[model samples]
Target chain A: MSATLVPVDEAPAPGASRTKPRLAAWIGYAGITAVLLLFAFGSPFFLTASNIATILTQASVFGIAGVGLAIVIIAGGDDVLNGGIDLSTGAVAGLAGTVTALAAAAGTPGMVAVLYGVLVATAIGVVNGLSVTLGLRPLLATLATMGVAASLELVFSQNLKIAVTGGFFEAARGSVLFGIPLVAWLMALIGAAVWWVYGKTSWGVNSYAVGQNPTAAQVAGLDPRRYRLASYVLSSALAGLAGTLLVARLSAAVPGIGTQILLDIILVAYMSMIFSRRRLVSVVGTVLAAVFVAALDNGLTLLGVASQWVGAAKGLLILLVLASVTLRGRKNR
Target chain B: MSTIETLAAPVEPSPGPVAAYSGKKRGTLQASRLVAPGTLALILIVFSVLSPVIFTVGNLFGILGQVALLALAAIGLTLVVRAGGIDLSIGVALDLGALASAWLIHDGYRAWVAVAGGLLCALAVGAVNALLIVILRIPAFLATLSVWFAGTSVQQLLTGGGAPIYLSAPLVPDGFAVIGRGYFLGIDAAIVNAVSISLVVALLLGITRYGRKLTMAGEQPSAARISGLRTNALIASAYLLCAVIAGFAGVVLAARSNGYVPGSGQAYLMDAIGAVFIGATISRYGRVSVGGTLIGVVIFGLLDNGLNLIGLSFFWQDLARGLVLLSILLAAVVLGRAKSRPATGIFALLRTTKHQALTNTAKGNRK
Candidate 1:
């Protein structure tokens, strides 16, 4: 799919001009640095290698998920359509972890458990895609499924702790290559896959075409609905993988663990989309955005800012980034 | 003949590949299929049959009491959405207003004064939203989301992480209690409040010039602008209207709850938006209709009430509600498109009408 309808005046051919976006990039870099410095100066707990690893470890799942979401956004399905929003990612992940836990409990091999979890998560993603394609407002459809999936998790084990009972949890907890968590490795795999599909696969082109101008894409023979569904499904699958890693790390599928996941993921993903310099989303860009946020939060926490104020800071960053994007987009138009 | 000349001709030979697609007729049919009350009716029946307690007076009143806050909140949102904008901050605005009112009442302020103060605060928030979007050039979604987060944090900070403000006996004067709990004729206060608000909004949307202009701006901004409508002003004013209504609703909810809690408004945001969206599907208005919103609220209320009566857990109830919403949207899309396509064998009125028009035009050309 190609966007042939060039809006009368083409804005400087995609990244061709030497004129640098120097200021925005600098501000972003500076913000990252300032937050890191503040953390280093404010607390002894912040400087520990373990703490740094922990922060990055925790940030990986969200960053991985951000890549998928970035695809959906760049593909031309505005996150707002059909009442669309993805609030179910965490729940989807939880369900996947629960499946893995159950299988692990049933004396399944670690590899089998992992496969089961991923498959279930992928199925859930497919459900999400179907609902969206069938014209259910994205939010409502996903919301319903989120509730269903969450409830199913509750009913599955009555909120039991099974992540540890299974060898799968051990694998999740295990370091694969010198102290790096298995979950971090999973993040890398997911990131690499996403990057490949986004940059090297035809799906990548279709995604951009769909997101940037669906009508144009449709005229050029791409099925907009199909691509939209695929993007959502891919996003759900990634989220599911993230969930599996979470359970593997935590050794449990606690019912309430997913409460803040959606908010955090959406904030980072939305912010990333707005700041995507290429006007097309990139895996690198999305992951970096997630890292930027995680760093900020960790830094703030290390700085001994009250936990309550941490949320406010996240909200403030979202405002600043999104505001800049909207303003800049308007100026370009 | 050149393709351009052939396109310029009103009556083309047979039909072009895309000539069958007509926007207005399809829109009307689609709009009719999307009406809100149908789902409400279905849910009401299903719930009534599912639980005997669902139809009981107390439960009905409970549902009404719950819906009042959201209904009020949604009135403002409906106005905003109708004018081609959204207010994610309504949730926070509700929080700020409810707490502000509670604080004032605790500080020995008159209940009415406190309520007014809350409304004013909400209005101020709305004004800020408007200014940010219209003047600062912030997108509606980002601006409102920021305000929402900021307002929520501000309220949280003010409370010092304490519990919500509780009203003393003196603050709950007879008049105030009456508004919160009293019955008007046979209808409870909550019902009365909800109905009255719905009616007022419906009237405003239906008869007012401003309402028409707002709708026009949303439906076709370029056309509206060409007609000299002040699109930005209308958009700003719409947010303002939504804020005031939401503010008032917040006060009412606080009164009903007997205090303002930190989490008071969090749960209602989705419900309010759902009602607005559902309501839009209900009428010819296409974006928002007060009656439709009422129906949406009723449907949701019934579902919740019935589910609770059946001893269903929170998770299942949420899933069911989401399913209903999703089904409604899907049904809208499917049914909407269904009507636009060649109808069934017995209902091929569209084909015939076009055929007749074409023949008549051909005869005139021959003459």
Candidate 2:
């Protein structure tokens, strides 16, 4: 049950931080701002306080999910296992949300519902971890889980949206600081916790160790299996947490909720390589990229463009990042 | 003995412990061939018993149509899977091509031109995927997955927020629908196409030098490189072939449906993957053979149609497919290990299980 320690981010431009031009770095962040500025100026209402708040609020769910995915991605350092990505992340989230909503609808207490949801999500992680460690190919394993989980959601919710009202939903949607929803703060807290673990603690070090070199980690007396297993657990827990919050925001839980969000979260993680100065998978990178994508979508919508075009924008943006990352990789190589 | 030899003929020659694999052959009954066909029959018998009122000859032929589309993509996917690479975007690439071609037919273009346009988009996608993997040095899985997401977005943009595009009967030539819907020689055209594709791809992979090199490079790039093979080019061609064929699958789908729906092609991904893997269980060398994949597709096609006959809910159908895929994957792993891990052998007796383990290592290194 040892994790195969292949550096996930090693496929990208490994020397991205060193090879990238200073001005390009500026452009990455500034371009996002420029997009924001264009929308603000071109569309008068975009600069309004309410519009800005709306964009941030919209980004919160993605922000939370992106951080979780980033954990799995960043867990590997030199010999990264980019294969550790959870394609079923969204489906697990949807399932968790559906279960939570179902419980709430069935007159279950709020804490019980939330607990039930979190447990289901965590179980998905444990399953994914088990499959990977226990001999199934990670990609196929997750894909299987994805299909099963999505269908299970349909089974759980009986192919119907489960709507609920409860104190938990209120806390999920209510604003505590700066008029932002509690979910946004939750995202920040989760991101901060992950960042702390990743940068400061032995868990982070062991994860990187396991990803980069399992044999060495084992020699150093660390169980790469535990860190690898824990990585998926932490990631899915956050996804479940976000999905629960999403149920509150949308005021209903659907079987297919994570279908789109999962893709967006992965995109957020991958795009982090470009948006971040370091080009490594990190909590800061994931959160910023989530906001960046959310902002881009918001800007386009504000400019009166149809939502479909935003999809095209995302595709083109990924290609741009990929191309840039390749260029940097070649320069360094 | 002839049957045993035929069954054992397709095993991968380059890897796996010969002693272990051949040990199963000593029984005069190969495991892979027995189990795959056995499972398909089991499913048929059990499901048919459960829903005798629904199973019929006509229904089986109708199910062939469903098998056709999945087989086409699965065959294309076999090109990459054989090379130890993957094309995660094939499903979406099919949709992209379908939407593009359907858009053309929606305009004033000839049906053939529109189909060509769709294939062109698929080729473009494949080339981009190849560039990412070969040049950027990205893993085939991630490279293809990224493009898959991007491809979905592209489809959304083309449809303008997931709108459906239609090609009416009068909108294109009469032969347009014939590709997918028309019957040829007392069989569905889609089935004809799938069979023809399987034959051609099988011949090239089994008989051609390029195909051998592809398998070689895919199995062991360092070995292939040392042998003077252009491993990158070989890998690149696999990606290209996968995309181009998938593009054609998209064309056929468009013809059958008379247009494109934003996410119509996504459903095929699971079955296509299932077909390829299931093919491994039936292959001569435990390798992915086009013929084996074709069989795999038929099994899946039947399962899908049979489940429909049984009146399973759509979610249950998905659940069934997922469960089936996991079982197939698990079976392959178990069967492969049993074959590769000898209970005892002439060479195997002296060889540690650790030494024999690498036989399967370089073969299924999808991760």
Candidate 3:
């Protein structure tokens, strides 16, 4: 444990004096205008309710995952020291969902089955943490777990999709009391919780301090290994939650559930982290970034573009965000 | 005794007490590297023993072909990794380069021209990666991942999201096929390609000033820069070399498969990275060795071939690979720790037990 340090006083506090230069503000405004124009004149399909709903759904899952991943990135630093990437998030979710479905198929209670799935997900996270804390490179460690998780999914269940328990599916798929989608509600709750923990807890300060300098943190009487382990564990658990919900909503755990999901999750999360300009992880920022990507994907699909085209666009957007952030960082320096 | 001697022979000189302690702490880590390939080999041998077809020439050759492409790329990657940069984009670069070469051939360009074009294309991508990392200031991991995304996109665009091209020119096919298909005095083409690349890369890395610079950058980037070594230039060269080799391997790979798809080269990225890291865990049981990577690739290939011959599903193959990577990584860590911490000494003894005491007391006070 360490002293709790509020991020608000760190730099670029929300609602503080506007630091936006005229040029940056104009560019931001212009970018928004361009997006609006694209939606308006590029295609009428962009305004469809189904398209909007699908985009929201996509954003909700990805945004939740992004928030969790961003915390790890912010806690680890620029180099992702000890190789602290959480690539297995999608795979963990996939495996967890598959297991949950398998259990439900065998007559397990929905609640109990879901709990088992989450525990499995936590185990994956624990393995990731153990490897990194014990000196396994983060990328290699997660990559290994990803393979294991993917294989386990295939072994436990063939490529076939399994239906979730009726109650769980209906509950997850339905809208909340308000007009909000259940997925959106879940995402919002996760995001708000993350924001609170990151801003108001000793854990958050420890994470930031550890990322800034692991050796220094250790010298300062902090257990760098413990913080990193906890961060990875939390991140993995959150990812498991995302996976469980995805399976519940869809009513099936399909093979390849997390196939290529890492691309979007990592890209958007990193973009959000960069946009915050503090190199600090922000749940709100990651959610917005995910929303932006989901909107783009949804809009393009509605416009009749192929999925491959959408993939290409995602890559371009990642590059654009990375480039802009990098340029800005250099300028500040 | 022979086994013990072999294991202990390659061990680096213990750096006094600190080194001895580190060595002891790294016991599991040292064991893990060899363990991965060993486990892989064991599974392979067991499968091969059970399945007659696993030992057949054609099937073995097929596996060799796959291993060759992966080993060549891993060799190139070894340099970059040794220089402290990992190239995630190599896989995509290979795809893009292959596509470029294939496109050239399809457009009536000579085979040599196509190959050159591929190499040039790879070099260009590699250079851009360097600029991003060395000049514009991006971390290698992110920069390389970006390149992966960009390169794959470009490949998809050029191929129009279609299947990979097949080259059918007679002489070109035959000559290139020999490198991936034809055997020399009973040696498989793929094995030849892998062995040749390994030898060349090993020699270059072990004997050249460039190799020294590569390690220098990896071990201490700041110090290397301070030495006025043109660190960025060296790094760019290393990445470029890695990309070119990957590109060449790509073409050879496409020929072996007889066609391409978006996912053709996808599997190789993880395999190559694993091989390189695992190999790095070989020397001193915790350092990298080209010889070790060759063994890694061969073990992987044997495992894949043997499993398929034994009729195991893809799930089993994936599981085996995962277990190998994790086990080896774990071994490397254990070995590294063992090497850094001495097995005995007053200060060392105090550091472990007393340190815990101090921390516990400190925590109690804070509470």
Q: Pick by TM-score: which candidate is best?
A: 1
On residues A1-333, what C-alpha lDDT tens digit does candidate 1 reach at each position?
A: 012211311122333222456354345556667877877888888868777667767878788767666666655344343223566777777777788778877888878887888888778778877876654556556666776667676767577666446544675676655666556666667777877776666777666655544434555677767876887788778877777677777877666565457667777677664444433345766777776777778877767777668767877877777666655544444
Binned by DockQ into CAPRI classes (incorrect, acceptable, medium, high), candidate 3 is: acceptable
Taken in order, the candidates have interface RMSDs of: 13.0, 14.9, 17.1
Per-prediction DockQ comes to 0.21, 0.18, 0.24
Cα error, candidate 2, residue A148 (Å): 0.8
Q: Model 1, range B160-215, lDDT digits (tens) per residue?
A: 96467888765676655565667889777866887888788888888989789988
Off by over 4 Å in 1: A1-22, A44-47, A78-85, A98-114, A136-140, A150-167, A174-176, B1-22, B26-36, B56-59, B341-367
Fnat by candidate, in order: 0.23, 0.24, 0.28
lDDT value, residue B272 of candidate 2? 83
- The second chain of candidate 2 has a TM-score of 0.84
Off by over 4 Å in 2: A1-49, A75-82, A215-221, A275-278, B1-38, B53-55, B104-109, B136-139, B156-162, B170-172, B281-286, B334-367
Clashes of 2: 12
Ranking by lDDT: 2, 3, 1
Q: Judged by lDDT relative to the true structure, which candidate is superior, 1 or 3?
A: 3
> How accurate locally is residue B117 in candidate 1, as Cα lDDT from 0 to 100?
89
* lDDT per residue as tens, model 2, A1-333: 112321222233334334545555555677667777888888888867777676676777788877777776654331122235777788888988998999899999887897899899999888877665544555566677888888889988888888889777876666657766566677778778887877677677667555543434455577756776677788888888878878888889976877878878877877777765444566777787877888888889878987666776776677667666556544433
